[model samples]
Target: MSTPLRLSTVILPVRRWHEGGRRSWERAEDLGFHAAYSYDHLSWRSFRDTTWFGAIPTLTAAATVTERLRLGTLVTSPNFRHPVTLAKELITLDDISGGRLTLGIGAGGSGFDATALGREAWTPRERADRFAEFVPLLDRLLTEDAVTHRGTHYSADEARNIPGCVQRPRLPFAVAATGPRGMRLAAEYGQAWVTTGDPRLSEAGTPRQSRDAIRDQIERLGKACADLGRDPDTLDKVLLTGFTPDKNDPLRSVDAFVDFAGRHAELGITEIVVHEPVPGTVFAADESVYERIATEALPRLG
Candidate 1:
């Protein structure tokens, strides 16, 4: 099978700058990115160096401004909103994008994401277990008729989606996962699996480890599928990572990108959602990042 082309996006993570939101998204599409993504964070844990983009509104702005680029959340917490309401919002965005929408979800295992929203941080295992039940509930609501039942921590009665999603019934739903349960949930119920690297973050000489991690995740996902009697080869697995564009030389920079691309691709990464930070915020957040991405990077890589 052919590997899908890789591309990136600038994050507008829970801060407010509508102009920046519009510009970055427009620029991403004009510069040939595949999508624009945002994160869900009600408030920053530390105010030391902070930025927050009210995710939904910022993404609505992105959807309005850009014509072709798909928009998505890195991941949204399932506990924070009723599945019915969240499904409505997603379907609304689907209409806005004319079907170019990707939905990513998980229990969101971090305190930074959870505690800030007045929710408790789930133990990794609990998040995994919760995911096992969570994925089925969403699947039934989005695809079947009259989903009604209860699970360990959630319940719904005939909560079928209204207006129905305009995207194909099997829309590109994804799950954010880094370990076993998340991986398997993605395999069974997702159009794609999306996750950033480990919480420790990336460093020099560690691409190989990241590669190993993904391979293991994919293998686990495959096993999870097999146990369920589901075919494993058909799933689209993706990684959410930052793409670093270097200015000094195209060869080295593009090589770095390909290595970045290949490391994940080798382990069944069907797509890459580049989390290239916006200028003036964090790493690679400068004109140089955009310049290298535009002038030096795309030409060599694509």
Candidate 2:
């Protein structure tokens, strides 16, 4: 049987909790989204000048107001975070959320976050190297009582997580990657694999090309799993919309999304996460159309 398609949303941390953030999350749950994620960045592009909030605190606050909606970072990174500290926060967040937290992690990018900590940004190779160490160390930190590790990029000494994650063997990791090394990590450690299609083609590529790119990515993920003697089908494939060539087409109307989703679903995507319309920003869309996609289009997928 094919995996059932799940719909989710990413609510950027641009709104203050009292103002509208809380309502957005509550509405997402009411709308029946499988999960609601926020960007785990210190400050994202364009929105950097606005009221950007921290991902951890935002999700933690959302947890209090939500009951069943799974909360998580769209893709947290080691950019300015250490495994030791992040794991502690994640454990608390998971417990508070009643084991309804997923950690969407990646190798991170060299944008604002890379230099926000007052340090030189890492090269692509360096970022990949750090990511390799970050995931395993984080895994151990969330699962073990005390961890001691020494690595080239990060280190922890007898770090203690008194009570481990609420989720057994630690909360699920939805690793974001489109490269070989990263795919290997996802196969080895991730419960889900995330992709945003191809960045190179985000601006100039056609929808067909974007789908082809994702198809290739899924194929690579399968091979990585095969090399590790693991089943590729075991990992959930997630596509975070907007970065693909399809862009806002999926949000233009219910039928557009249904069509866009059906095409990607054929490529093995189990979950599709669309951004909640933030007018005037790159994520701008028709809110009513977006809601229709949630309330109307999703059921049609089944």
- Single out the weakest 10-residue window by summed lDDT for candidate 2: 290-299
Model 1 lDDT at residue 12: 54
TM-score per candidate, chains pooled: 0.83, 0.99
RMSD of 1: 3.7
The best candidate by TM-score is 2
How far residue 273's Cα lies from its native spot in candidate 2, in Å, is 0.2
Candidate 1 global lDDT: 0.65
TM-score of 2: 0.99
Model 1 lDDT tens row, 53-117: 56777777778888888888777766465565666677777787787777778766565655655
Model 1 lDDT at residue 14:
37
lDDT per residue, candidate 2, 197-236, as tens digits? 9999999999999999999999999999999999999999
Any residue pairs clashing in model 2, and if so which?
Answer: none
Superposed by TM-score, candidate 2 places the C-alpha of residue 196 at a distance from the truth, in angstroms, of 0.2
